[model samples]
Target chain A: MPGYPPAALLLEDSMKTALRKKLLRDMLFARRFEEQCYQDYQVRKIGGFLHLYPGQEACAHGVMAAARPGEDYVITGYRDHVHALVCGVPAKEVMAELYGKATGSSGGFGGSMHIFDASKHFMGGYALVGGPFPLAAGLAKALKMQGRDEIAICFLGDAANNQGTFHETLNMASVWELPVLFICENNLYGIGTSIERSTAELDQYKRVAAYRIPAAQADGQDIEVVHEAAQIAVNHVREKGTPYFLELKTYRFRGHSMSDGGAYRSKEEVEEWRKKDPLEILLARMIEDGEITREEYDAWDEEILSEIEDEIVPFAENSPDPDPADLTRYVLVEDDPYVHGGPSKGGA
Target chain B: MPVMNIIQAVNSALDGALAADEDVFVFGEDVGRFGGVFRATDGLQAKHGENRVFDTPLSEAGIIGTAIGMAIYGLKPVPEIQFSDFIYPAFDQIVNEMAKFRYRSGGQYPCGVTVRTPFGGGIRGGHYHSQSPEAYFAHTAGLKVVVPSDPYTAKGLLLTAIDDPDPVIFLEPKRIYRAARAEVPEEPYRLPFAAAVDREGEHVSIITYGAVLHEAREAADLLAENDISAEIIDVRSLVPLDEETILASVRKTGRVVIVHEAARTCGYGAELAALIAEKALMHLEAPILRVTGYDTPFPYTLEQQYLPDALKIFEACETTVDF
Candidate 1:
């Protein structure tokens, strides 16, 4: 573990106490959200490919924590529930979207793969691998053109690091000095395939240095460490108005999704990572600093469960199935002017 | 008024549009400094600087996708694809994102962008460079497609495209870039979509657009020598096909010929031919004639035979006359 950074020691005193508590709360929320999605999938409540952001919670939390809400934009791939929630899309709507209800974000038309909230500055949950890279560059160009001191954060998996769009977008962004942060969430695997087996470059952060853009690596599991690294990258993007890259070294606790069995990696390897789980690390730090007593932690757990039971479960249950007639609604704006339900006309 | 070729008309129109509005910007390969391969953007980059008139990396997808983002950010981006054949790489963005943005987001997002690409095949540049992709875009909803035949209409329609509410796919005829010249207006004006009617004869209606329009006119002249007076109808707008003008011409002529350089199957001509059959069946004195490229892929060796020329138009017209 000498090569690996320590969780509690890696944090600043202020970040360790306050930020650690906040991260713990957010991570628990994300875990519960993923658990609910699994239950929903079993009962036939959710359909289509549902990629849970369970193990990748720290990257989302830390990156969003560093960005100013409504100023910066966040664009990520389909494994994006935590990214959306962390960027401030309401939990109920995120749940409803997966349930394919009229009240869901994108009016249930986008479902899990294409959740978008322009108001919250979560640009989209683009399904195409590396599609968001060029899109994020365009957004950064727009922001720069408007003279706004804002950076667009583009998140992709380590597997997407080899995609040509990533290189093209990064080169263009660097050349134009566009304000963007290209964060590669290296979960060590693309589905069941290991990074080393797929790509020649294990040190993905060095790829961005070729474009002369500033780059860094972070322990994506530790929220405090990620937050510090993100803050540095975000500041560089803001001050220099240039693209920055952060290679987030992380791991997935789940087997890609509900479909995959735990056949690819050994149970011992899973157990090893589970011991250094992001949630447990933050919870331990919060308890050690006396931020929350055991009683408080227990009460918070009860509160989250009840909130899920009363709000999420019922919302999923009572939410109307999308009207069959409205299937063609979000596909294109019709003569009647298609209006998505439960939100303002702005699709927030 | 000054007489100008298709290229000059386009260049003046773009310059005028840029001057008329501060938001209009041009970006594409060789569009800046090099002044575009067809010289459609000649001297504009020098006048507008690199910001307003610039060159993008040689990715058609990037040119279009970035233009969509720019349009969403409230800039009137008139992106150019170097050639019509090369526009396929960006087809997904155009058909999926740009065309559907206004409708998909429930009008929350409207991409008011224009794409200007040179299409059609009289030139010797085989498969990759010579293609008329107007029908592909016309098949898509939420897109206003235009292909002007002459200098005057090209200037007016280009301006209208730059100022239109939705995204416009302006397909310029590369084969006739400087082949024909006509007087173009110095002042800015818009020739409304579905509003190009030529009054020549009551014998036969020759309907066409883009490069084939000139050929249609020549065929009409040749028909006139044989005492066959043919009316020429220029379908300046493909998507919103000038139904009123087309129908009126059909009503008078009682015979029709639809000509286009795209393939014989599922081309823009098919739609016009179908419309005439549906709306003006009773008015027809003869069968509808369609002069178009063969169904096969555009070949390199038989390039001249592949293109629809004056002879093809005359042959189709002769059949209509015989009927």
Candidate 2:
């Protein structure tokens, strides 16, 4: 912004302006959406476990910015409101999903963690830690078998790195030369434990080289940095039909969730990360580079805040709760045409 | 037509499916270069490219879970579990995901794939390898369970199982993999899931499947020598059981004995016994009997005692006639 950095010159002014506006809108929408979830959690409007994706908004928005909407598949862990939102899941529906309403993405069956919109190509928001790993690998295999150029994007936290499934999935993805982008959102701490204390190899993408897979590490806090790095990784995955790994180094601003007491990390560390907030950084750049006036950035923030106030929360509040009778509707099919359920008049 | 064993029939079925449909692919442990541990998928990788027939990581969950995803994307993936005993690791994938996918998705997606596992107690595989777990799957709603006793039915039924719209659990009796051989049609054929009446008689009815079918046959032979006529029925498919054929045989025979190598408490045999008792109760001359493996942990050393053999079937038949 100050001196037209050589890397920054690669993007034209109009392209940069449009990208900045979209990134701000999506990231701010995610932030405001999750912030409303925190409020809903306190009021008990949304029950069960709720994981927030506050500071890691840039990672989801940045990656989806590079990947296609309907063509690609997106899978992530429980902290997936932002991922679903970035993939074009209506903010109101995602909020209602957290509320466990009938209008939610999964018809209130999956609650917060198991949200899925097959039509939108958001494969799932699997609750089990690292449970989506093998599924992502399979999705990549399916895409490859169908001779499609689309890739799969799988998001995992730092804690998932310790799971054997993580290794198993990566190895299988690499061996099959599947088109998948494994995005490890290294937000310093997984749930509550810091990465250094839990994980042996802190640099996760470097671990992929042992499996002969291509990988890179980028700053997760910077939207443009993440977007650019992801573009390269996504392109490489699509062109080569091989797995690509990305370890985005970022930090979560809030506690793991509304329940966390913030006892796991220091206030000083949290403040330090908050200082480099992605939204603030983008706003500063937009102002300093003369890309937009301060009024525009203020207007964008107002729009996100007003949308969260007037759209997502109100829609969730007005949404109907799931009917008790329909609780067991999806559990099993009452009449499966494939297998005769009750009695068969025997004859071959 | 070609005469082959159970394993050879499986290989033929896989080869035929792969050649017929470009979407059909096989992957599992030792399935590619080694042609599978039991050679059930023999020579598939060589004939088809590695892309179609490949070996996967030694992970049951991975194999089953990935197959679910592949099936959702319109690919017909036939994953091998090496052995039925080893499929427990994938129990969640089978029970939770694959079994419930169609229903859970509100019919938006169906897990239309096949899982081929070798089952039954023979060849002295002991507890780990030699066990019949069909009852567990039979309890599942969305799954189709079929056990092929001989090669001819193995090929035809396996082809049908592969092409079935729903997920099918094709359990081949590993004990009879090479022991049982028959002439199978060279060209494709289909075997309906209903029961096949092997021998027709008027005195007693013997309903069985898999390894127990051989015992029933031997017992039927012995009953014939003793001047007692017995009808033999082989239930090719356990889930979509051939109740009509079984009831018809029992009505004619006026007596029934259900046999299976699985534990006695609650097996597919129990289901068959209840079905006969419910439908053809008026036709019964005596009470229905069941001769099954004892209800105990499949003992490693005492497998012979734990398993029901031809002698037990003969004893049960005699008791049924005496009653």
Candidate 3:
């Protein structure tokens, strides 16, 4: 069995200059998109819990870069807008979903926390902690049973590891030798509680050792580091037909949700982590390597901001609210015999 | 037609599903080589191979959560909980995830998982081993709750449940798994999610399902001796409850006695009573009476006293007829 890939192969000349620039562009776009969402929530245009993915852009971008989007299955926790966008779900649909519009990915039924786009194979963004663990394993089991090479990629937070499903699924995934990559975006704190306080074993990757799965940790702030580690982990799972765990050491720059004031953490701690911002680190690396001029980077940023403002925002704002008359739709299959005429005033 | 017990009929239904669709999979603890603790999946693994019918880790959440995932990927999975009492661990997954998959995803993902588990008390099993939890799932929308009273209903209803394009909680009456024997069709068949009018009468109506259906039959026979005609209706499905059938029976009989093995508090009988009171209040000559277990945990030593028996059903029917 292959252990964690050696660090000697890190940042080899394998990543082309063009790909690196594209990743940076994607990460910047995601950051701007989340900022736009935060603004929309403040204006009451986006309702329900809004979990912005600002500081953890590199995690989704890096892992998705290593896997075949729209083919391999992807599942994640509620902090999932960026993951959906990276998996090829249109930004307009994701925004519309947050706005609870019919044009949204889930037809407005599932708001921010439950984004789903089956066409993109982005299975879903589950709201319950540790709920996606076994679902991801099931997806992998499906692929293996069908003799398909596609693997299932699951993204969860450090706190979700405390859920019993985390242990049950890992053991099953290892015992069955399913093809799955379990990505732990360790943002240090699960909401207000710090990892050290909640978990006895602070190292999330070390927890996977009990299941006898190969595991590693990577710098989540740097896209290059995340991509390289993800590539090794993804390949190991697909080739060996086994599970692998990859923990990204990162931090969320914002509160857990829109309602949170984030008084739990010290201001200095927040500022200290923000100093290693993922976007700034990537931009600095590109500048040092002369990949693009600073002026060009500024112009690209402006163009993305304009697109979000002019096109994406308008699409979500103009999308229609779901019809109340069709409130009971999708409760069952479309042609279900009991769909239109069945027991009335029952539970759901 | 082949005469088989409820366990054999369940195994036969699973056999037909596995042979009919390559996507259908049967899995649970001790279901593969051991043929399930109740043997409801006996000889399935051998006939369908390990991949199609296999055992899983002893985790209800893992069993159900994985079934949802497979269902999302366009596969049919029939997962079993060893017992209904042990299903609480996966309650979140079933209620929050599996039941809401179709609704939450806007129909993009229809989780057509058929969760099979044996429930109700008859043997000396304690509270943990015996529990009728159908009311819990029936209370939740987007889930179909079905219970089988005999071999014929078991085979036909199991097949229909697997074919339905929604999640179903297929609760089997373990008490009558072997005792309830009848002639079941040899080939695949489907039974709609409606009540079956087991016997017809006019004086009083006895509505029941699962193992208690047999008790209701005994109660009906007892009523017949007294020249008091009684009707017996087996509620095959609970969620998409056939209210019309129940109401028509209520309208004809003018008296009702609902029976179930679950506790009386918030039991399925409550729903039936409320529905009758709401829709057929004018036709009712007497208040709807319920024959059910007490609002207490199932007692191991006094299980017979705890469960609703034929005598209980007979007394409740007599009271309704006299009123």
Candidate 4:
């Protein structure tokens, strides 16, 4: 921001101001939302597993910022509230989803890890690492068939790099020239184990080039850096009808999940990463660019904090739970209209 | 109507599906150009072009996962896993992703792909190529597990599997791929996802599906030779478990002998036996008998011994009727 980055230069001053504010606010909203989720988890308001997306906000917000929502497909592993939020799924509904309320994106059927809104083109909250790779390829295949330039963004974890699907889907995506961006969120650690202990080759995108697909990595802590990388990946796949792999080098501020004791990593290492926190970096950049003063940054933080506290949480809490009868819904349907959960038959 | 083997009928059914719906396409290992290992999708790539029918990398997970993505994008993708034994690579996709898509989406998305895989023993494919894994798919809730006994049913059931608005695991008995023959209609005719009694009797009901049905028939013949009437119940569809038709047959027979080529432990035959014990136990003339493969893994050389043969089924039927 200090030296007029190329991405900012491509946009008008007003457009740049609007986008920068949007990116910062988007990242802040995600941070505040996940923080609220953490609080809710502590109070037992959020049940099951809770994976927060605080430090890696740039990966979600930046990639989604480069996306054409409602046209492109966005899929991610379990740490996915931010993906759903960035893709325009109602923040209140996402909160409701975590609360297991029927008003959630997946109607409470998908709690914490599984959130899908077809209307928003937010594909799914695949809880399995490397689970969404093939699906992302298929989504990109569908876009290719429909003659659309929209790409599918698949957010896989660093741990997922060793999965057979990681290699299988990447190979297929390359062979078929599918329009998918396999964004590996290399947050240094997978759950508790560091990447060095997990994957043999630490540079994931390098191995991805085995399939001959163009691959690169970005500083996922910097919003502008991530945005630039994602834009290149998105534009390349959208235009070339091929796949691109981007490894976002970032760190998770919190444990892999709520249950982790943070005993796996060192205090010094955590402190070092926290120093380059994406939110703080973006805030510093915005302040340095004269887009916002420190006072305005603090004020924006307050607004986002209140937005989640006063608005989203209450909506999620007040949301209804699903009926017992809807349990067998969406199994199979007749071809006439493609419906789900047919008339009740005598139970065996 | 033309007489064809299970492989031809399967190919015809795929061709029909491709012609019926432009959105329908078939992809798998050796499915295109080579027309599949068994030629089940034979001449399909040539007829339908490389796009509609194509070969895939020898990655079952990739094939199934790609089909899922295509299915979600409004396409009827029929992905073959080459052999059911080889489907383990794609198990995560089939079980975790495809099977759970619709229910997890709360009716927003339906995993409408038909996973056609050749399964069952007697092909001498050892552990890697020959195995009956229908129980694995049947045990899964959201998947439709169909094991056809003949060509007509194979074609019709494949058609139905493709048409069903959910994922289907079409387990073709590789043992009877070319062994079984029937006059499948040239034009596509939908088959009901219900059991059909190939041969009906009253004393001992030999319930089976896939390749084991042949053994069941031989056992029925053995019973006929002994002046015993055996009602052979072919379990056409495994998942929905046509308990009504099966129980009706069991009620008439008063005794049951379940037969399968899968391992005795947790095999589909156990489920069938449990179903009879649960719903129609009062009508049981004897403790229901299971003529099944050994608990050990399918052996390469000892397959003939490992798989349940006609003699084993016949002996079981005789024991059931005598008891």
**Local error of candidate 3 at B236, Å?**
32
Q: Write the per-residue lDDT of candidate 1 for residues A1-348, one digit (tens) a residue.
A: 022334554544347456666777878888888888888887777765567877778888888788885568999987888888888888888888777676776666567767888889989886556678999999999999999997899999987775568888989998898999998998887655566555777878877778988788888887777887787789889998888898888888887656556465788988887876888777787778788877877787788888988997788668886665543243243665533221011101
Model 3 residue B88 CA deviation (Å) reads: 6.6
Model 4 C-alpha lDDT per residue in residues B1-323, reported as the tens digit of each score: 68999999998899999998999999876577656666788788888898999766545677789999999998999998766876887899999999999999998998899999888777544445567888888899899999899898999999999999899999998778888888889999899899999897979888899888988888789889999999998999998788998999988988887888777767887798788889998987787877776655554334566677788777777776776
Candidate no. 1 TM-score: 0.52
| Count of clashes in candidate 1 | 1
lDDT of 3 by residue, B73-178 (tens): 9999999987898688799999999999999999899999999999998754544567889999998988999998999999999999999889999999998999
Per-residue C-alpha lDDT of model 2 across residues A200-259, encoded as one tens digit per residue: 688878778888888888888888878888888898899989998988988888876555
- Rank by lDDT, descending? 3, 4, 2, 1
The residue ranges of model 4 lying beyond 4 angstroms of the native Cα positions read A1-15, A334-348, B1-323
Off by over 4 Å in 2: A1-15, A337-348, B1-323
- TM-score (chain B) of candidate 2: 0.98
Superposition error at B264 for model 2 (Å): 21
Per TM-score, what order, best first?
3, 4, 1, 2
Instruction: Report interface Cα RMSD per prediction.
Output: 20.8, 17.0, 17.8, 18.0
The residue ranges of model 1 lying beyond 4 angstroms of the native Cα positions read: A1-13, A331-348, B1-323
Per-model TM-score of chain B: 0.97, 0.98, 0.99, 0.98
Q: Which of 3 and 4 is the better model by lDDT?
A: 3
- Model 1 lDDT tens row, B275-298: 988999999888787777765444
The residue-by-residue lDDT of candidate 3 on A1-348, one tens digit each, is: 333445567655447889988998999999999999999989988865678898999999999899998888999988999999999999999999888788989877677877899999999997667789999999999999999999999999997886788999999999999999999999987665576655778778998998999999888888888888898899999899999999999899999888667766789999998998988888888888888888988999999999999999999999887775444356467666542321112222
Q: Cα deviation in Å at residue B84, candidate 1?
A: 24
